[model samples]
Target: MFKISRRKSVNLSIAVALSFIAVVAVIAVLIPFAWENTPYFSKLVNDVVINESQQLGRCVFFVWLYICFAIVEACCVMVFVLLIRVRKGLVFSEISVDCLRYISWLCMLLSLFLFVGEIFHPLMFVMAMAVVFLGLCLRVTKNVIELATSIKQEHDFTI
Candidate 1:
């Protein structure tokens, strides 16, 4: 019977955690670039040119805040994966496949929205990279689901 070894399970968990962290990092870097270059933000700045320093400070603060937020998010995802691995067996499961698919789709949709917003914000390249990353994640999830289902069916037949 085809089975997922413990080592493979640990590796897959690590891979997913790494991917999640990478995605969050991309988003953290992209948002600030988009905000600073956006025409609406610029117009807002022009309206209060006298408070330029404050505005700049606020932007910097927000970027830092988001960086922290991304780190927390990544940590949460990693911890959750680790907990699952430690508690349950490491074999591929429907829940894991669904989580992967959901995250990929949501991130892709979010990236698309951000990219379109970049028309006025002017961070097209960053958003484009995010889109590509999300696309690859979606592909990964699709393959994972297929592989899991195939193996499950084979196991069932043998039993």
Candidate 2:
């Protein structure tokens, strides 16, 4: 049994997510150096589909990677905040809905960016589709949260 107290669990999740963001930030900053020094990756980055049939340059590919990583970090931050709200007993608040909405939009933004990247790289096509699907699911979840918030407000008023 993996039973754990809710507060401890929430704190652990938040810590893990923050750690992930930090690690991703560090990796994103070192991406250029990594691509330059890693022999196999350097070759792949330079000799991939870009120079052949794709119009995107090496700089553009790096830019795409940075943007995607930024979006992921942003999403993780939002999730962290949302979990905090849950811990604070604001589970059905409008703020939570707004946070969810922003996350959904972020997902869509990542999807659009990946779609453009996919036009040239072709490898990003699956990732783009997956992000778009994630955005759609988040939108649905936001709606559900919004409804619950409204119902809770009404119930509170009646009480």
lDDT of 2 by residue, 38-145 (tens): 875545455665365323556667777788898999999999899899889898998999999999999999999988876445678898899999999999999999
List where candidate 2 sits over 4 angstroms from the true fold: 44-56
> Against the unseen true structure, what C-alpha lDDT does each candidate score?
0.60, 0.85
Top candidate when judged by TM-score against the true structure? 2
Clashes of 1: 0
lDDT winner: 2
| Residue 126 accuracy (lDDT) in model 1 | 91
RMSD values, in order shown: 8.6, 2.7
Cα-based TM-score, every candidate = 0.46, 0.86
Candidate 1 on 22-77: residue-level lDDT in tens?
A: 77778767766886677665554444433457567456446544644553464447
Candidate 2: worst-modelled 10 consecutive residues by lDDT:
48-57
**Cα misplacement distance, residue 108 of candidate 1 (Å):** 1.0
